[model samples]
Target: MVDADQTFVIVGGGLAGAKAAETLRAEGFRGRVILISDERDHPYERPPLSKGYLLGAADRDSALVHEAAWYAAHDIELHLGQTVDALDTAGRTVRLGDDGTLVHYDKLLLATGAEPRRLDVPGTGLAGVHHLRRFAHAERLKGVLAALGRDNGHLLIAGAGWIGLEVAAAGRHYGAEVTVVEPAPTPLHGVLGPELGNVFAELHREHGVRFQFGAKLTEIVGQDGLVLAARTEDGEEHPAHAVLAAIGAAPRTALAEAAGLELAPREQGGGIAVDASLRTSDPHVFAAGDVAAFPHPLFGVRLRVEHWANALNGGPAAARAMLGQEVVHDRVPYFFSDQYDLGMEYSGWAPPGAYDQVVIRGDAGKREFIAFWMKDGRVLAGMNVNVWDVTPAIQDLIRGGATVDPDALSDPRVPLDALVP
Candidate 1:
């Protein structure tokens, strides 16, 4: 149980940390809640950084978790631009950055999120080479994107993951020539599989975005410390006024590892390991957001979700666990993406090679479809593309452990509820 007098310290003032603070107040914990972030800005949502914010459709204030006054109004201490230098779990203290101020805590939540996986290739350190992770990165990339529009320049994007693809869309929207290079046979094939991945490939190709698949970037060539072009392993050169590396991210786990916290197995991507309740090896410490690798009850597998939904839901779940509530972070993993006119919502867990077959409802040619992944006739996961008002039904089918017929699942006329069991 939590004591009203004790202080609760939350590290990594991103969505997860901010939501944890909100949960504490909503759950009626009158303790001193202190949230810390290395970034100078207050906690903010990251989704917009790649879409609206980068395109000038939204502003920094629009992405913030709360306005500057909300923290004070809610009595939550906001520590921005300050890194937690050390975590002394036995001493129950966290050392602050530079100033070396030690903040004592009765309980701690490690919401330390992930950082972009750096590119080690040559010229990655160039001025025009960028990675999208923080608001600062977005701000710089936004300027380059605007410049690309004015100059009618080319933008070379490394990796065809969600961030890379989203940025490619934004770049094309700004009238820049966009070229995406992915090492896979099909973009996003590792996750969405080849069939669906080809859908995205077609979407981009229709919009005149070029693709270089089955090839890796050998070098990022630069002139005067600015990106000029990128060379592929096959020796093809692609011109670029700017380069964006969207390779993916690695969970920030130095603090947890240094403090002797257990980590998930190597096969699980090596994140801070936690139980269903989000508690770390030490009962006094907890982990959430992208940093946490917890056992997912639905699939009976460990997953480290890096999407916004996980952070939004995991925050409150971890908080309830901290308060001695019987909490299970068993929510079906969900994620959505918007690229050009295509918007998609996916629900449930489908570990690689886990689903035996896929059933498609709606027309893939029209870029409107719901693809269902099944195992032993039971729906394990589903994704709706350009489809509306069916997320709840899709989720129900997944959570209800219902066996759905392929013909019915592929037919739009059949009500999703009727397909249940």
Candidate 2:
């Protein structure tokens, strides 16, 4: 077992890494804790990039997870713009950046997180094309938007996932004519499934956002260093002055792989295999947030959740394990979306191939509604659109393993509180 006073090295300064440092402190760890981040700045939240920050509803200072003096006062060292180059498991040291600075750690937390996946199509390197992964990436996109006078620019976004849609919403709010292209027949099908994706697709369409669903891009051509258009797999072409690639992100697991940690086959998504306790195959290291493919008790499978809630919750859960504290780390997977007149709250887990029921507790078409996914006579998952009021009741039902009565749940006049056990 690792000694308590030895140094703790956490690589990566995204949500997980920052929170892990905080967790280490909270768990009464007095060891030398260093957060090495390749980012030029200290840790910051990413959720605001797509909405509040992009819309000027908030500034960079408004989204920080901690006060400026918090890290200093906590004695957590911050290593900015320092990339960990190598991991020597035998030596228990990590090599950082081009300078080859090495640091020893009795225990290590590999919260390295993920990097955005890019389209390898031709002309992707052209100007006016971007990807959203860090604050810098979003800053570049926002700079492009600001320089082009916002609405005057025609923005073409590839992929219809959350980031793509969120960016589209931001661009739309700025009056830019946004076109989102998704090779899939429907957006977010791989996550929420096709039925719910349809709701989101319709929402975007109604907001005047154009869809190029099921269109595969063969090339992204440019003229004079500027993005001109995207050539479809079918030879069809569409004008695209600015192209934002929102395809997806892959775990930054190079160091973990180099350290001889057993890898979970990522043929499906390229995330790292982590046990229920967020421990990697290598006992000395643990992973969390977007990089971790953790076993789900409710889904009966492994899941890699990429959202604010997962990052916020997973970091500390892994920290508890690192501190020799047994943490169950169980929480209903939850995510929220705020776009154009809609505030969505989703909770719970869904079993695979179990397409059976959706019990609505309120008017779906109206501003407030709750939909529950039930299987095997128990509440399994739920999504509430503009129905924040009813979510606590639904959470209670899910927590207690109570099977919600569909007839009573759907009764127009019945309150969501009625579903509580």
Candidate 3:
């Protein structure tokens, strides 16, 4: 049994932090668990903020991962809108905002997560330019979409990642002529290979979305309190009434750095360092979610994943580590995205150029396909669009390090049950 009066303090009120709290309770931890958050609302799912929430398909309440009543019933204290000022790791206390009281913690989990990255270009501070990360940011975008009410108004998007493409699709659905600008030759060059990126480029182009591949943002011009257009180094000006910066997210490692914890280079500025057991340099402290770049034994490298699946799975692993459980938690890295009536799913871990064989489970022509990643005859990762039921099965196969015939797996007649161990 755990200490009755022990306190567990969790930073961030996103899925990772909330799941850590839930996992702690599920493991019979009856101690006081206080969840600190800078947002006004409780924990919520973030993936839908860019698509469903912006399109009016999902609401504020629906975005939340868990009900508020559930937290209250579980006796989980919420310090909403409380910004963590500092962390006294040696003292085992977290310093909060000016008025907020300092919290004492026996075990601290740093699930502080990440924030939307912004451009440093001129006119970026203009009224219409925005980046989506929190609920408030999405609300602002939704409001702009409602007020403008103009289809064909140029909406220029920076970056060509999944979120940027989703926003471009939404703008197209709203009848706005959208243009995507990326410094990379192809979209999602870091995750999906060039071939898949080419497919996405074609798909978006077919829907009337324009692409400025290999274009870089130089300046965001503003006039009289409104953004007018942005320029590229090539002296090209793209007229845009509004701009959505979807470059990427930077992990919130300010507190960790201030606390003098070990840090490592991530895709962004930095990600916190953690062992296979998910413990930081200071064993009493642990980090998870986007902030934690775990050392992946299977992938043979450390990875910082920013996905709902990762937050949900890693959160529990961090808690389990604190509870003295030995867990590798190197499960298949899975993620999903919902766009324009299309359900997309990604399962397992496929490093750059690691796959030698590509297996197609369904028909791509039918807009239903699952492309399995097989490296050295082992299934590493997959891309499943409109075919997500096999995600869990693929995840298990990857975890178990099992291999199957590529031809047999690709056939549409193959069952997910047969793919299982």
Candidate 4:
């Protein structure tokens, strides 16, 4: 077992890393904790980047995980703008950036997070093309959006996922003409299924966001080193003064692969493999957040989630495991998103083609409803959209393995708790 006073190193200074440091201290570990961040700034929240901050509803300070003084007061060492060159797992050391600073650790946690995937088609590297991942990226995009609104220019977004939809809302709020091009027929089809995805599509359509559904981007057209339009496979050019690529993200796993740690199989999305306790193949190493692929107790499969709740919960669980504590880390998966006037909270997992039935409570056509995905009368997943004070009831139904009646669930008069037990 590692000693209390030994050094604990956490790579990737994001939400997971920050919370791990906080958990180690709260668990009474009097060890030396060091957090290494690639970005110069400390860890901050990412959700606000697409919603509040991007719309100028919030500021940078509001997104911070903690102020600079908090790190100093907590006696945690913060290394900003530093990259880990290599992980010497056998030697229990990490080689730092170009200077080759070597740091020894009794325990190491890899929360390296994920990087935004770039559009690889032609004319992607031109100016006025942006991808939102970092605070700087959001700041730059906000400026471009302001300019777009002032000139009433067109903003072309290449993806219709959560980020893409949220940015489209922001662009529309700022008076810019917005167009979203999704390869899929509907937005968020992979997660929410077609019925619910259509709700979002209709919502955007009501707000004047044009859709180029079932289309592939052939190229991004630029002139004088700035984006001017995006051409789809149909050979039609859409005017775009600025472009935002929100395709998706890939986990940062170079260090884990180089260290020879096990990775999830190809079918599982290629994340770093870890047990229920978040312990990696190496006894002294552990992983959390977006990079971790752990067994899901409810779904009976390995799952990797990229969202705020997973990182917030997994970090503390991994810290406890590192301290020689027995941990299952079996909390139900949860995530929430805010797009326009719609606020959504989703709990539980229903992998693609896993659920056989969907039951909706309230009026889906009116954009107020709770959707339950079920298999053989048992709830597999539940989503509350534009509905308030119902998440707890939905989560209890999912976790308790309660067989719910479809008629009662659809009835607004039926209390959610009564449908369970």
Q: Relative to the unseen true structure, what is the C-alpha lDDT of residue 240 in candidate 3, on a scale of 0 to 100?
A: 85
All predictions: root-mean-square deviation over Cα?
1.0, 2.2, 2.1, 1.2
List, residue by residue over 30-136, the lDDT tens digit for candidate 1.
88999999999999999999989998899889999889999999999999999998999999999998799999998899999999998878888899889999999
Q: Cα miss at 161, model 3 (Å)? A: 0.8
Clashing pairs in 2: none
lDDT of 3 by residue, 1-421 (tens): 6787899889999999999899988999889999999999889989878888888888889988789888988888988888998999899999988575778999899999998898978889899898999989888887776554464477889999988988887787777878899988888876776656776787788888888988889888889979789898789999988998999999889999999988877542378988887788897999989898888877777778889988999999998888878878686677887667677888777755777777777777666888777887777887888875777777776766777878788877778668767
Better of 3 and 4 by TM-score: 4
Superposed Cα RMSD, model 2: 2.2
Alpha-carbon runs more than 4 Å astray in model 3: 149-151, 267-269, 402-404, 414-421
Ranking by TM-score: 1, 4, 3, 2
What are the TM-scores, per candidate, against the unseen true structure?
0.98, 0.93, 0.94, 0.98
Worst 10 residues of 2 by lDDT: 143-152
**Candidate 3: how many backbone clashes?**
0
What lDDT does model 2 reach? 0.80
> Residue pairs in steric clash, candidate 1?
none
Q: What total of clashing residue pairs does each candidate reach?
A: 0, 0, 0, 0
